[model samples]
Each structure stands twice: as C-alpha cells, then as structure tokens.
Target: MRSKPLLRVRKTGALMVAAVIAFVCAVPLAGAMWQLTPVLLIPVVVFVWAWRAGTDVYADELRVRALVGSTRVPWQRVSELAPDAGGQISALLDNGNVIRLTGVTSDNLPRVLAAGGQQIGHSDQPPS
Candidate 1:
C-alpha cells in the first residue's frame, strides 16, 4: 500500500482543454439547433479519452490506462523503457512484449521513471 497517491504521467494537458472547449461550443449549438444535440457525443468521447488515457505509477506496479481499459505491469516485469518510431515511450517487458505507455514520451520519460521509483542516470534518457 502506498502512503501517497499514485503518480501519473499523461499526454499534453492540451487534450483536456480541447475537450472542454468542444463541450462548451457544443452546448449552445445543441440547445438552439436541437439537431446538434447528437453532436455532443463527439465532445463526450473526446473528454473521456483525453481525461482517462494515461499511466499511473503505483508502489508495486504501473498501470497503463486507456479510454476503454487498463493494463498493469509489475516493476520487476519491466526490462526497459524505450521510444517508438513515433517518439512515444514504451516498456519492454521481461516476457518480451512491449507495452506502449499512452502518455509517455522521451521528454517525460525521466519523470515517469522517477515516479516509478527507478533511478535516472546522468544521461538525458533512460537506457536503451
């Protein structure tokens, strides 16, 4: 059990802001046009995806949460964290499968590593 709340790593905060803007814009259109009410679904989905997608670092394990589901990997199971071609960070698991950390990127990898209780070296990036 962790004494502190889980540490989180997320994509740009811009996503959530966009979701809010979309919802605000849709509200008036939906109320006036009536037919635009169904359009509200778009912002709702965006809000869920933007707000829910991220990785949460717990004491014993790390959870990669997505819009629809989540996957938890124990610290011992992670062999390394590397970036994909798209520059998104991924975890190379001991079992040989790679788990793409949704909100993790090279720039934020160090923070994520620290939150996971992994020590960072002098290098700008984690070990390849």
Candidate 2:
C-alpha cells in the first residue's frame, strides 16, 4: 500500500516575518533617500529568497527549491543525514556535497527519515 504524500517542509513562517521586516526598513529609507532606493534591493532579494527557497523530502528523493527552479536528489545519492550545530538537518551526498535542509530541524529528523523510507520503527506502532 502506498503512504500518503509527504507534507511540504515549513519555511513560510520565516518568510512572512522577513517580508515585514524588510518592508519596514526599506520603505522609510527609500522615501527619505530617493537616490538610495537601490539599497532596498538587498531586503527585496532576501524576501524573495525566503519566499522561494525550501526543501521537500519525498519517498525516493529530496527536492531543493529556489526562486526560479528546483533540484532533485534521489535517496541513493544521500549518504548521510544529521543535525547541524544550529539545529538544522544537513545531508551529505554521495557526490561530496553537504546540503542544509531549509525547513527541517533535529526535532523533525525522524519524521523526515520515515518519509524518505527509512525504517524508524516507532514504539507506538504494532509490530508486523
């Protein structure tokens, strides 16, 4: 039997907060310093990144999203998964690249693993 689809990772909350902070700082400055309106690009870029960037874990692969597109890494390419110092989950790929999962944390690592088809064997489930 197939399991339900993996839920999307949670990064939108941070995006909303970042958008608000960016506008608050950029608008007044842009109004007062018309010539420096270009400076607002910095915050605008950050807001766009926050809105566009995210990671999605699937049964067979991991998807990393960006403003314009996304990249998919199959489970076979995943060599390691662990929590980093800042609490984000990081993956070491067989290609020797380490990618930080945008919305995943240590606390949610087990869930992500299960969604990726790792046998988590939770005690709460009855043994087959």
Candidate 3:
C-alpha cells in the first residue's frame, strides 16, 4: 500500500477555466463541419493534462506525473533539486539524469524539500 503524499504541487486552477473556455469556443467550430470534430479533443486533452499533471512529494520519494506517465525517484537517488532560469524545479539524480518536476517551482521549492523532511543548509556557512 502507498502512503499519503506529504505534498502535491499542481498547476493553478486557472488552467481548468481556460480549458472550459476553449472547449466552449471549439464546440461551434466542431459543429460547423465534420472535418473539424477532432478539434474538440484539444481542450479535452488540455483539461485532462492540467487535472493530472503534478509533483507528489512523499517522505521517501518523489513522484512526478505528466499527462501520460509518471516517474518515481527515491530520496536516496536524488542528488539535488535545482531551479532553471524560468524558475521551474528539476531533480538531479545520482545517475546523472535530470527530471523536471511538473508543477514544482522555485518559490515553493523550500516547501517541497520540507515535505520530504530535507533540512536546508547553506554550503557557504561554516559548520559549528
């Protein structure tokens, strides 16, 4: 059995609103012609992706989920959590692979770390 997640970082609810708006607008276009019916799938896919994509932080591991799949990284395998220029967080693994965290951001990185029971310490600071 899986334990409850300590933290779940997901896209803002605004994406759901956008998906609804897009679907509403696409309905008229889809109704106008049979060839355009596939257009309806766009908003549906977006809605599902927004609803499902996120990062789940557990005490012993991290689960990063996308629209189609999820990757699990044990805490022991994580070498570092890094932020990119765009402020998105990524995890560097001991195997030298980087996994971009779906919904984790620089601003909330500390919270994610805390949820995993990681203590924050500055490398520049001298040890007592």
Q: Highest TM-score: which candidate?
A: 3
> Using lDDT as the measure, which candidate wins?
3
Model 1 scores a C-alpha lDDT of 0.85
Q: Residue by residue across 59-110, what tens digits does model 3's lDDT show?
A: 9999999999999999999988888999999988999999999999989999
Per-residue C-alpha lDDT of model 2 across residues 4-85, encoded as one tens digit per residue: 4484676767776877788788888899979988878887777777776777778888887776787788888888887878
Backbone collision count in every prediction?
Answer: 0, 0, 0
Q: How far is candidate 2 from the true structure (C-alpha RMSD, Å)?
A: 6.3
The lDDT per prediction is: 0.85, 0.78, 0.93
Better of 1 and 2 by lDDT: 1
List candidate 3 segments past 4 Å from native.
125-128
Model 2 misplacement above 4 A: 1-5, 67-69, 120-128
Instruction: Give the winner by lDDT: 2 or 3.
Output: 3
How does model 1 score by TM-score? 0.79
